[model samples]
Target: MTDIVMEAKNVYKTYGGSSKKADLKLVEAVKDVSLQIRKGDIKLIFGPSGSGKSTFLRCLAMLDIPDKGEIYLGDECLTKPGVDLNKARARIGFVFQNIYLFRHLTALGNVELALRRVLKLPKEEARERALAALTEVRVTDCANKYPAQMSGGQAQRVGIARAIVRNPDIILLDEPTSALDPELTGEVIDTLRDLAKEGTTMLIVSHEMPFARDVAEEMIFYDEGKIVETGPPSVFFNAPSTDRAKKFMDRIIKRTTRE
Candidate 1:
């Protein structure tokens, strides 16, 4: 058996209980979703916008509370309804589409904040860790720059730096390259691939299909809040089992093979 680092069982989430008109509908963001990510695996959860991909990632990161189901992080239960959610959250590092950083803090400060407050490390130690994280993303030169002063890619590097500085074994990325251009996207993707090589477990919800095929050890196609197909990249891309995957590939070709 693969060394499992994270697992989600029977997970479900609903949003929007009320509507402006009386014909309100509760959107099921995630529906009975279950999957396991092995240690050192780079797994991609591919889905369209509003397909619950982000919500699923947030639930995995413990940034959002799930309505039903159980989540396990290295044998620790995350969703017990009344369990201590903070402890569960501390174990997963999260990076998002938008780089959330303090406007006044430098890139180094952004990465060091969590180390200083959450990890309770001394200032020098935290700064050293932050520097290492920035170096990992090849953005150590931007350490003293503010978020507003840096490029989107540099800001994103800082975001990744902040997430990894905690040294969490599992990193959850939520559409991390959604706003980045191709060049910048490649930079972060390269950094992530290096992390995967170093044995860090990663769960990525992304739209970049080619990157998924190249970097992910395995991938799942999510639609209507369900995983319709899942397998290694070769099987997922070349021998998808379901019609949903076929249709998805068709769209991918239509978009990519366009003149």
Candidate 2:
């Protein structure tokens, strides 16, 4: 059997609840969601804006705690409130849409800092791992450059290198290419494809349809905080089981052809 790296069971998460009548209403971001990510699986999630895909990814990464249900990393419980999470969290990596590199730090320094501080690797070892990671993303040439000095793509590559320096069991990305121009976006997509080929398990929430269809082992269509359909790209892209999925594909195709 393929090993599962992360699993969610009936997970639920909400935001912005208040007793006051004038206050914003509660938003159910994830509702009764359950899924498993197998080792080395490139799982792609697609949905419209505010469809809860990003929220679910954050819950998996534990950046946003779920209001109900359970999450597991391997055999250990990961979502129990107040549980010791350092070890569980250490095994996961996350890259966000907004590349959050410290402007003062060089690309190499940014990656090395995560290795030394979070993983507590020795200085020399961290340097070696950081450089390897930079090379993996083809950002080695930008290692000594600061974030302000690099293009959007280069900065994001550094962000990815920092995320993978420790070799986490699974990497989570939220709209990694949504902000880049076509040329830069292609580079990021190429880097991600290389990682997938190298057996890095990933859960990606993206609108890059072509890349998702090509790289994903499984694709999920989420709507209103629920997974409407899940299948391989061959089925999801060509023959979606749900009307919502079909409509989504139609809209996307129309938009692409128009552009």
Candidate 3:
């Protein structure tokens, strides 16, 4: 049997609230979404703006809690509201689109901080792991450089290194290349592809179709808080069965051609 690394069941999340007189609109960002990710599987989630892909990713990462549903990392329950979130978070790495390294910290410092603070490793051991993680992302040369001294791509590599240094079972990426220049995105994508080859299970929120097609085991088409389609790239890209999916693909094509 395939080992299920993580699973989300009937998850629902909403935002916005109301006072006594004011009617606050509730936005259902994630709607009864169920998903399963097997060990070493790379799943890509794609959608346009306001499609709730990022919110869904945050829910998976436990950066945000769902209003209702259960999230499981193997046999451990992650969405029980009062559950030990720190323990759950330790098992999942997260790379955000915006690189938020400490301004004063060098690349090695940024990565080692996570190991020391979250994993509680000794300074010497954390330093060793940090270097290994930086080398894995091919950013060892930038180890001594602060975020301000590095390029966008190089900084992102350090962010990735921070995530992987924890040795989590899954790594969640939120539009990891969206903030990067078209040219600068290649290095980060290369690192991600290498991670895939090394059997790092990942769930990525992205619109970078070419990278997803090449590395993703499956693609999920999420729009308006729901999954419109889910399948291998061959099926989702070449033979989308839903009208919503077809229109979304058309939009992607138009945007790509214009660029």
lDDT by candidate, in order shown: 0.84, 0.90, 0.91
Deviation in Å, model 1, residue 32 alpha carbon: 0.5
Q: How well does each candidate superpose onto the true structure, as a TM-score?
A: 0.93, 0.96, 0.96
Candidate 2 TM-score, C-alpha based: 0.96
Residue 115 error for model 3, in Å?
1.0
RMSD (Cα, Å) for all candidates, in order, is 2.0, 1.4, 1.4
Please, what are the lDDT tens digits per residue for candidate 1 over residues 1-259? 5478899999998887876777567899999999998888889888667888888888777777789998888777887667777666767789987888899999999999988887789999999999999999899899999999998888887898888888786899988888988888888888887887788888988867777878888888998888878889888677789888878877875775572
TM-score of 1: 0.93
Which scores higher on TM-score, 1 or 3? 3
Location of the lowest summed lDDT over 10 successive residues in candidate 2 = 80-89
| 84-190 per-residue lDDT for model 3 (tens digits) | 99888989999998998999999999999978888889999999999999999999999999999999999999999999998899999999999999888999999
The list of candidate 3 runs beyond 4 A from truth reads none
